[model samples]
Each structure stands twice: as structure tokens, then as C-alpha cells.
Target: MTGKTALVTGGSRGIGRAISLRLARDGVRVAVHYGRDDQAAKQTVADIEALGGEAFAIKADLEEADSADRLWQAFDAEASGLDILVNNAAIIAPGPFAEQTQEQLARLFAVNVQAPFLLVQQGLSRLREGGRIINISSGVTRIAWPNDVAYSMTKGALNTMTLALAKELGPRGITVNSVAPGIIETDMNPWLADPVAADAAAAYSVFGRVGRPADVADVVAFVASEDARWMTGQYVDATGGSQL
Candidate 1:
């Protein structure tokens, strides 16, 4: 991956941040995309540079209507080709089905589903053969999560897209896959700060511990590598055997 270029959406924080750093360490030129946290994104780039890796930050709000186009436009200005794309940007607004508003539903779909679809569509022209498209899905799609019904539904759609696109792009030697993680400890889940709540969340996994961003990032790194060329259209359970 030394000369290859990769883009990681939402690379400013959480699992996205971990992915950006890990890939850079593997010798890939990383384009770290962030929606609003420019400072965090720069820090990620700096961290990569400090380790003798190459990285730059790109900003585009995935929730915006023209985000995909704008993101590619910015990316094209810096790099002419791409080898890997990690769609890790998503919003999770948890609530009962009935409590979800029309606006909330639309936002959820736009960010979690539409953005990734559009990004891939736009990137096809630049993505080299044997490229990788990895979607960061959630384990909520496999297990029941009524509180996050809308968010989970979007991931289900992403999984379907991953399968279909893997077949569509197979002849081109590109791979598309979804990685689903469960009960990850991130700022998004503030309740984890409570010891009791944290333990309850950890119990969901057979590992008896909360998943870390690196856990998912490491799995993603493998999917992006040449070693995974034979694997595609699959849902990798990065959930530590959750709900088993």
C-alpha cells in the first residue's frame, strides 16, 4: 500500500480515526475526511506524519445534499487516483420507532445510506482496479435494537448495497463488504461512562468487554489489504461474538 491512496470518511474521530492511523502505518497515503471537526482531523494527520506516514485532511458534511460531489472535488484537487474507500461516517439518533420524526428519518438515511452510495458512485472513475470499498455497518442490523430502528435500517440497506455492488464490480476486481461492530466504546455512547451501564453493554459480547475503535479498525485494515482479495460481498462480524 506504499504508493496507494485511500480515503476514510469521518476520519476525525472514533473508529474512523483509528482506521486512518492504521492504514497510514501500513504505508498508504491517507485522505482523512471529517464533517465538522477540522482540528481533530488535523491532529490525525499530524499523528500520521509524526510516524513517518503521509496524510491530509478533507472536510465535507455527509448529511449535506451535495456532499459526495464536493468531497470528490476536494479530493481530486490533492490526489488523482484512489485505491481504498472506507465509508465510516454515520449518525445514530436512537429512539422508539414511533418517536422518530420525518426529518430525523430523512437525515438518518441521507447520512448513513445515501452518502456512501453517492461517494462510491463518484469514486468509481478514480478508484483503481482491485480497489476496496468497506462500509462501516452496525451489529444492530443483526440483533434487535428497537431504540435505534431507523439507524439500524440504514445499515441493513448498506449491507444490501455492499452485496450487490460486490457482484457488479467483481469483473473489475474491486471488493465491497460491510463490517459490523457491536457496543463500541465511543463518545457517541456516553452512557458507557457509568460503570453499571458499561458492564451491561459489555455483556452483549462473549469477550465480556466493550469493543474499541482499534478492534474494528484492525478488521477493516485486513479487508483493505491484498490478503483479502478473495473475500467480498460478506458481512464481517467485528462484534466479538456478540449476541451469540
Candidate 2:
């Protein structure tokens, strides 16, 4: 991946941050995309540079309709072509089915589903023929999570999109897949700060431990590598055998 280029959305923090760093270490020049958090984005780029890797930060709010265009425009200005596209930026609207507002439902889908779909659609031209497309999905798509019904739905849609895209782009040798993680310890899951909540969350996994950002990042690295060239249109579970 020394001469390759990759883009990781939401690359400033949490799991996205780890993915950005890992990819950079693997010799890929990373375009770290962040919606907000200018400082975090800068820090990620600095970290990558410190490791003798090349990286640059780009900002675009995925919730907005024109995010895809804006992101690609910025990317094109920095690099000539892309070898990997990681759709890791997403928002979760946590609530019961009845408690979800119309606006919440719409925004959730817009950011989590629409943004990824549009990104891939607009990025196809720039993405090389044998490039990789990885969607950061969630284990909720296969498990029951009533507390965040709508968030789960968004991931389900993402999974379907991955399957369809893998088939559609197969002729061009572009492998598309979804990686589903469970109970990851990130800012998005603040409840993990509580010892009791953390233990309960850990119990969901056979490993009996909370999933780390690096854990997911490592799986993503494999998927983005030439070693995974034959795998496509599959849901690669990074869930630690959760709910098994």
C-alpha cells in the first residue's frame, strides 16, 4: 500500500481514528475526514506524519446533502486517485421505536445510509479498478436492540448497500464489504463509562471484554489488504462472538 491512497471518514476520533492511523502505518497515504473537531483531525494527521506516513485532513459534515460532493472535491484537490474508501462516519439516534421523532429518523438515515451510498456513487470514478470499499456497519443489524431501533435500521440498510455494491462493482474488481462490530468502547457509547454498564456490555461478547478501537481497526486493515482480495459482499463480524 506504499503508493496507494485511502480515505477514512470520521477519521479524527474513536474507531475511525484508529483505522486512519493503522492504514497510515501500512504505508497508505490516508485522507482523514472529519465533520467537526479541527484539533482532532490535525492531531491525527500529525500522528501519522510522526510515524513517517503521509496524511491530510478534510472536513465535511456527512449529515448534509452535499457532503459527498464536498468531500470528493477536497480529496481530488489533494490526491490524484483513491485505492480504498472507508465509510466510517455515522451518527446514532438512540431511542425506542415510539420515542423516535420524524426529524431524528430522517437525520439518522441521511447521515448513516444516504451519505455512504452517495460517497460510493460519486467516488467510483476516482476509486481505482481493484480498489476496496468497506462500510463500518454494526452488530445490531443481526441482533435485537430495541433501545436503538432506528439506528439498527440504518446499519441494516448499510449492509444491504454493501451486498448490492459488491455485485454491481464486481466486474471492475472493486470489493465491497461491511464490517460489523459490537459493544465497542467509543465516545458514542458513553454508557460504558459506568462500571456496571461496561460489564454488562462486555458480557454480550464471548470474550467477556469490551471491544477496543484497535480491534476493529486491525480487522479493517486485513479487509483493506491484498490478502482479502477474494472476499467481497460479505459481513465480516468483528463482534467478539457477541450474543452467541
Candidate 3:
């Protein structure tokens, strides 16, 4: 991936941060996108630079209607084109279907579904042939999560998008795939700090441990690499054998 450029949405923290650092280590110029955390974004960039890798921070609220355009505009200002696009920004609102508000549903879909769809649509013009598109989906789509019904549905849609786009973009040699992780130990799930809760979550994985951000990041790095050139339209199970 030397000299290649990658744009990692939500790359300022959690799984995103790990991915940014890992890809940078692979010699890819990373554009770390953050929604509201400027400090965290800057820190990620600094870390990459400290390792003799190239990286920059780009900020755009994914909840906005025109977020894709704004983000691309900002990215294009620095880089002339793109080779990898990782849609990793998402939100999870836990609530039963009956208790989920219309506003909550809208916001969830806007950020998780619409933003990625639109970003890919706009990115097609900038993404070169043989480019890669990696969508960060959740394993909840495979297992039932009634409390996270809305979030699960969004990931399901993303997975479907990955399948459809992989075929549509096959002629161009651009692969589109989704990486689904289960119970990753990230800031997004602070509840894992509890030993009991963490232990229960770890039981889901055959490895008997809660997955770290680097675990998912490593899978993503492979999917984005030339090693996966012939692999597309697939859902990578980065959940450490969860529910298998």
C-alpha cells in the first residue's frame, strides 16, 4: 500500500484509530476523519507522523445531509484522488423496537446508512480503478439484538449494499466488502469495563476474550491490501469466531 491514499471515516478513535495507525504503518497516506473530536483526530495524525507515516485529519458531521460532499471537498483539497475508502463511522442506540423514536431511527439511518451510501456515490468519481471500499458493519446482523434493532438493520442494509456494489463495480476492478466485528472492546462500549459483563461478552468468541480494536484493524488492513484483490462481495467475520 506504499504511496496509496486511504480515507478512514471515524478514524480518530476506537476501531477507527487502530485502523488508521495500522494502515499508516503499511505506508498508506491516511486521512483520518472525525465527527466532533478534534483533539483525538490530531492525536491520531501525530501518532502516524511519529512513526514516519503520512496522515491528516478531516472533520465532517456524518449526520448532515451533505456530509459526503463536504468530506470529499475537504479530502480533494489535499489529495487529488483516493484508493481506499473505509466507512467506519456509526452509532448504536439501544432501545426496543417499540421504544425507538422516529427521530432516533432517522438519525441512525442517516449516519449509518445514508452517509455511507452517499459517500460511495460521490467517491466513485474520485476513487480510482482497482480501489477498495470497506464498510465497517456489526455482527449484530447475524445475531439477534432486539435492543439494538435499528442499528442492526442499518448494518444489514450496509452488507446488502456491499454485495450489490461489488457486482456493479467488478468491471472496474474495485472491490466492495463489509467487515463485521462482534463485541469489540472500544470506548463505544464502556459497559465492558465491568468484569462480569466483559467475561460474558468474551464467552461469545471462541478465543474467550473480548476483541481488541487492533484485531478488527488487522482484518481491515488485509482486506484493503492487494492480497485480497480477488476477494469481493464478501462479509469478513472479524468477530473471533463469535456464535460459530
The C-alpha RMSD in Å for every predicted model, in order, reads 0.6, 0.6, 0.6
Prediction 3 global C-alpha lDDT: 0.96
Give the alpha carbon lDDT tens digit for every residue of 1-244 in model 2. Answer: 7899999999999999999999999999999999989999999999999999999999999988899999999999999999999999989888778889999999999989999999999999999999999999999998999999999999999999999999999999999999999889899999899999999999999999999999999999999999999999999999999999
TM-score, predicted candidate 3 vs. hidden true structure = 0.99
**Model 1 residue 34 CA deviation in Å:** 0.5
Which 10-residue window of candidate 1 scores lowest in summed lDDT?
Answer: 182-191
The regions of model 1 sitting more than 4 angstroms off are none
Show how many residue pairs clash in every candidate, following the order shown. 0, 0, 0
State the RMSD for candidate 1. 0.6
Clashing pairs for model 3 are none
- Residues 75-157, candidate 3, lDDT per residue (tens digit)? 99999999999999999889778999999999999999999999999999999999999999999989888889999999999
TM-score of each: 0.99, 0.99, 0.99
- Model 1: how far is 158 from its true place, Å? 0.4
